[model samples]
Target: MQNLLSIVIIGIGATAVMDLWGALRKPLLGVPPPNYAMLGRWIAHMTHGQFCHKSIAASPSIAAEQIIGWVAHYLTGIAFAALLIGISGPAWIQNPTMGPAFAVGTGTIAAPFLLMQPGMGAGFAGSKMPNPNAARLQSLLTHMAFGLGLYLSGLAVSLIC
Candidate 1:
């Protein structure tokens, strides 16, 4: 039960930290925050067997897509946290380190790079974008921030739990 609580806290906290970076990136680097609505749209279409899209923004919107996207986004973060814990073991919860958290956080980019981006018609790692390198860099930096978030959240959990 305690481990579960710690996982929830770490996941939500780390995800929130990632979100904070997203919000700041627009002003700091001219990169707009990710559109979760589009993520939701993609997910909704998945229910009907639609996966690939030329442009997710061009796809028709669905009911409560914003809500769905937000929920899924956070849930994905939690799942990532579970992955980190599962790999690092309970000892990590008691003595959080940056290495494993960083590995898991940045490694998760595989989901977007290989699956999400390709499915959204951006090619691998947003290679189809007008500025693919920039897009890829942004993704890398964002995941790094998520890694930092995991470390920070783990520290808090360790101290409190």
Candidate 2:
């Protein structure tokens, strides 16, 4: 129970940090935040046995996609946190080091590059986007931020727990 609580706290904290970065990036870099509604739509379609789309934007909209997307976002973050804990073990959670946290956080980019992007019709690693290189760079940076968040969150958890 303690370990579970620690994982959940760490995950939410890390994901919140990543979200903070996104909020800051908009005004500072003129980069728009991701549209989670599309993610929700994609997830909603999964219930109907649809995993891939030619263009998620062009696909039919689902009810409460925004809410669903945000929930999925947080759940995904929690899952990633669990993955980090599973790989690093309970000892790491107690110690809260940066190396392992970063390794797991940065490694998570594969999900979007291989599965989420392609499934949403953005092509592999956003290759189909108008600015593929830019998209790739953004994704890399975002994941790195997530890695940093994981480390920071881990540190917080270590201090608290």
In order, candidate lDDTs are: 0.91, 0.91
lDDT of 2: 0.91
Candidate 1: tens digits of C-alpha lDDT, residues 40-118:
9889999999999999888899999999999998999888999999999978999999999999999988888999999
- The TM-score obtained by model 2 is 0.97
* Candidate 1, pairs of clashing residues: none
- Runs in model 2 with CA error above 4 Å? none
TM-score of decoy 1: 0.97
- lDDT tens string, model 2, 1-161? 99899888888888888888888879988999888999999999999999999999999999999999989988888899999999999888889889988988899899899999999999999999999999998888888889899999999889888
Model 2: weakest 10-residue lDDT segment is: 16-25
Cα RMSD to native, each candidate?
A: 0.8, 0.8
